[model samples]
Target chain A: MTVELASIEGQRPDGQEREQDLSKSPLSIRGLTVTYGEKPAVFSVDMTVQPGQMTAIIGPNGAGKSTMLKAALGIVPPVSGRVQVFGRPLEEQRARIAYVPQRASVDWDFPTRVIDVVLMGLYRELGLLSRIRGEHKARAQECLERVGMADFAERQIGQLSGGQQQRVFLARALAQGADLYLLDEPFAGVDAATEKAIISVLKSLRAAGKTVVVVHHDLATVAEYFDNVFLINTRRVAEGPVAEAFTEATLQAAYGGRLATTQVSQLAHKA
Target chain B: MSGEEFVPLSLTPLLIGVFAAVACALPGNFLLLRRQALIGDAISHVVLPGIVVAFLISGAISAGPMMLGAAGAAVVAVVLIEAIRRLGRIEPGAAMGVVFTTMFAGGVLLLEQTDTSTVHLDVEHALYGNLESLIWLDAIGWSSLLDAEALSNLPVELPRMALTLVGVCLFIAVFWRALKISTFDEGFARTMGIRTNALGLGLVITAAVAAVAAFDAVGSIIVIAMFICPPAAARMMTNRLEAQIGWSVGFAVIAAVVGYVLAGYGPLWLGQQDAVSAAGMIATISGLILALAAVFGPCRSRAGAPAGV
Candidate 1:
């Protein structure tokens, strides 16, 4: 039913590459609807992220923010949607993208070194028997140092602080050498220093013309951290520049009664 | 234990026990980390029907056909467990319990109905293997280890288990990074374009191969024990995966040797008339090792109240 409307921006091109220019938006989704059993998670959600922009996907908890991102990435099955990256299907541009998942999604007790976690970013080039060569280690080390975690290379991953763990994940994404980065709650449950370090790394990525999209929670940090905001609550609400789309009306619409009036107003005024 | 006396009777079973334990323990490390340790128990339990069906089909107790049967059974059990879990909407542990137990029961009943007057295929043999009987009658002494003819007469289970261990080791070595990543964080592995589902299936299948091979040699008792106890105990010892695997292999070898010697001679030392089952003792020893590690291993606790918290 929404296919006709989604056709306005063009259908998600089949797996084949389109002749469109490479300057197309880094990510674009049309008519995306996802459901788990009978309950809909995201419905008819359409979002587009322009190149070189820092965008935040914000919604109240359980508003399908993560699901929408996952569906767009083909991590989760979407009922009806087309997702494209750089004017081509996502699979085609995988080498140019890096994804930093949430900190809590993995078992922290896994027996691995901090450096090895960062080296996974270079997995694209690894072969069955290919050893982790000197160059790969150097790159991983550089990424770690970039995140200010240079001294904890040999430590067990389980022994690290949550903020340190999050830095390791970012370091991994940095090691990917990706043109586009997608992060899920990179700032959640981290110390202030960790938050500042992550934001700066992302800002550097933005300055280098790499598109970055984050699934964010803190409304207060929205205007400071991201250049654009995509507010979604089960469906697309408002999206655009932080100063324009992030208003009291949009915050109310996205948060609904779940957020107190004062909190929304405070966030809107803060933005 | 003199070499002349030990060469023919105890050598083959001891070597087979060690090989089987190490083979299962290698893959067991990843399974333990993945929290799929029960898959080993599941695979070991389900091996009974596989072996029984193979014996019935071939009308013999040969290794090849019995192995094939066991492999087929393991696959069936995995698929059925998955199906029940999905269709019935039950938890995975419950689904595994249901499928493995039902298949194991069916196997026990099948063993009862079959005619076994001439062969050694019985419920007791399947449950607790005849390890003492797998002797090297042709081995005259330690020199027999160097003799080609004597070597040829060695128990087939030895070579088979050695090959299985190598295969498991190779699989782990080749896919070590992927396994570690997928086991720790499946979503991130998938996002990195690794086929997590296929890799997971590959891992389960590898575990099944180890379980089936070890089950054939030493029975399901040791299979279940080796698949969990050694790796779990090793987990308490080290926080490094490389070190953990090293510790697991060491523990497995120790359990096999110590358990076999005790089973063979502990009875005489205690003034008993008969020897105990080497399989039972080996399992018990591994369990004891796990208990000890749980109490005193350096990394026994969960990494200092989890700094991440």
Candidate 2:
């Protein structure tokens, strides 16, 4: 696997108009496939995510948006494909990325402070058995402040609101110090204020030259929030600039048979 | 021996109690964190038949075979719990209740059918052992110069109870971080490159070892208490992982000493019925601690709040 990844890096085709550089492809997926038992959750797909860009993957329910993100991060293994990060294989480059799972995916009643959750972003860096140092705490506090959650740093995680929890998770991701961030359904169930905070954070991350890929459910917010969009339905339908890839036709392809064309058309108009 | 006779404080029970508390609390942290609080109860009960079957086969109380049997039985309980979820459409708690109780009942019936004289499988005794009666057996070996003079020659073959506890605790401490991550958010842990399956299996193994340890000290009935009460109490007191662990160890150790002392003195003071079983008393204390925490601990009203709003 290392050799294959090394070869791919060594054999980067010249003159391909590298968006960033061969050395800065934060995430790259080729012919990625994911299956749950015999059912294909995500079909063969290929894409490259450039650093310093806010990319949103938009699709209806069960369109494999989350699966693609997970598979790319090696959370869920791809049936057959290659996922490269920072010119290295996913395993070798784990510390270079952070993942924010869906807020609803965890038990809220777990007894942990907000700061502790954020400090988890440093786990890969600190490795197991290492204590959280003063510097780690300072960084965590900084991340919380960036998210307007500094005051709540000492709050029990279960005591926070949905938006607060989401910010805490984002803060953890920020504390990770990774070049790539993969977030799943981050905006789901969040208030408008929280949504704006998250978007601003994403923008700042992009401004800092970090790659951000989010599994977004709000179709209307896609064009406004993200610079690039990937429309998915078990497979990649289209991926490019938000304006070019998020048209009515692509929406039709991604949400076929599940959403009414009239409703999607209305959504497209809103977008 | 008269009630006034001094047995003197021995290191055996203390070491056993400390080791068991540490071992059980280590994995119990994960179980409590995962919200699978009743899993310990389920595993302990399920191990009953495994112990009986092992005894029937070996005709001796050997730690190795009994541990293997208990581990096997615990695995079966997990499988049954999953099966019930898949096939019976039952909630996990109900499935565990069904599996454990039935297995425990079957184990009792099987034990009754066997030789009553040679096999001393008294349910009450199993639930709470007479720690006072545990003879100060010979120490197993190698004492250093720093060791207390009296304890230097003490038997090292830690009572079956203490050895099991130390072994289980060591295992948990070694896998602390992995277990913590897995218990908190299995999906996220997996995404972060931690093997959730391996961590989960390790938790199960720890649970089995805890059960075996409890089998000799407090017995299977009260083992559930050791597995649960300390962690639950600790949960209410702190949010930091290290603090939680520290509180759990502190609570367990206190319960062990208090329970042991009560068992020794309460019988003479009351002068009638047998004093409450030390294990049961300790479990009761743990329960009381949990109750206090539930009532007085900070309320978790912010749970289920939306994120990134």
Candidate 3:
């Protein structure tokens, strides 16, 4: 089916547009509670991510950071919640949102080239039985070049290194041409150079007025990399401007006693 | 006698086998790529009861009733497997095992309840097809194409299989993009608004139709080998989907031809009087080709390719 391409921020002077503009947020989640069988993964949480900013969902292991992201995207059904993107339901605004799942979630050895993966980003727009035109191919190539992966566009995905593979995934996300991007662990295992490249790309996205939410774990660079932080430990611990919300107390609360040892290691590395 | 004397005798049966093999291989590629190869085997076995039940209800073997029964059985097989997997929280392979074994056993019991001996529908024929006996006993040579009598005498299985293969190829051609995207990455395809679940169901139903068509000529057991072997061997030869499909059809046709020739004439060359079972020989040839591809394929890692990959 052809995705009905419409403005993420509705253009008509209607009551709906007025309500959406009042929120002024790209994503709004209310009472998002997710449970797995007898245990609750995420307690009742309310979060609103502003437009045109880099928001980091930071938490320690088993803190439900990724689970929260999935719940917001409607990938995993929340026990009870509502997620609105651009004041519309997530199902209605999915075309305007790009989602990059964890690198481990996909089969890298699939018999497809890098260009094919990038082209998949456009499949929603192309619809069924339609040939991907030269313009689409050129756009895909442009996206690949943006991530410094144009040279590897024709290569099989499995042939790439770990860092290069992540770049290809980024290129695929870029090809979506979405105003909002949700990425999961973009720097989990990359080298410093790859990490720098990814951060620069994320910054460029913000400069272009695109909302980018990343699930991050490295506490050392959170202050430097993010404009806003949502520290979560099953429930929302602290959230706001990174300088104000990302305090030592918040980190200690989210990570428990582990934060002391992490601070010592951070200091030792600096020395 | 000249070698040309044997051409007309073997031509129709050989063509039928080739058509059935090629038809199975087309949808078989997707089944292999999707790692549902056992489902292909499952559909083939389950359709046996479908065909028998159709005969029982209709009190005769006809195309419409038989196809309806087979297609219904195929859908039931898929649904049951899914239900068991979801309810029992078991491995998909185990679920498939439970559903298909019960359906096949049900078919055997159904056969026992009735007299299938009067009709062409017997357990032995369904298991091992009587391919050698399907000779076009008409007046003459290859030049008899001008006579209506020769054409009329041609076996019914040949044309039916030919049409089935054509329909399968057309379906694949129409849905090539959807099939590729869904088989490679289903979750992403769904997020793209591709209706991936419907596409996946369409594929399984198409596979069932192709299996049922092939079953009439090649029998049920060998359909499994035809469904998995050539596609698997083709996967070893190429990493591109289009090239893989082409290689699969080529391999399937070659197996049909080589296997038929071996079964029909190899005994004569060995100083024996009668021919061997063509279905068994074709299945054996498919296995050999798969083994060969595993040993010396372009992709060296294809020896034990994981289903998830």
* Cα lDDT, model 1, residue A226: 86
TM-score of each: 0.92, 0.85, 0.86
Top TM-score hit? 1
lDDT tens per residue, model 3, A1-271: 1112224433642465534443457899899999888788899988999889999998889889999988887666789988887767777777878877777777676667889888988877876678889999999999998888889888877777778878888898899998789989999887787788889999999999889999998877887888899989999998898877777667777887767866935522432
* Candidate 3 lDDT by residue in tens digits, B1-309: 332455457777888889888889999998888888877788878888999999999988667788999988877888999999999999988998898899998987898789888777878778767677666777367676677977887878777888888998988998888888778776566556667777888888778878887787778756888999999999888767778899899999999989999998889999999988898889889989999998998864632233565
Q: Which residue runs of candidate 3 sit more than 4 Å off their true CA positions?
A: A1-23, A257-271, B1-9, B71-92, B133-155, B302-309
B8 Cα displacement, candidate 2 (Å): 4.8
Q: After superposition, how far is residue B266 of candidate 2 from its true place, in Å?
A: 2.6
Model 1 spans > 4 angstroms off: A1-22, B75-90, B304-309
Docking verdict class for candidate 1:
medium
Docking band of candidate 2? medium
**Each model's chain A TM-score:** 0.91, 0.89, 0.89
Tens digit of per-residue lDDT, candidate 1, span A1-271:
2333444567553333232333578899999999998999999999989888899999999889999988887778889999988766888777778989999988888888899999888888784568889999999999999999999999988888899999999999999998789999999999999999999999999999899999999998998888999999999999999988999999999988888899888888878
- Candidate 1 lDDT over residue span B1-309, tens digit each: 688879999999999999999999998998999888988888877878888889888998777887799888877987998999999999988998898899999998998998865676787777667788889999888999999999999988889888988999899998988887788778777777778889989998888888877777788889899999999999999998889999999999999999999998999999999999999999999999999999999998776355465
lDDT at residue B191 of model 3 (Cα atoms): 58
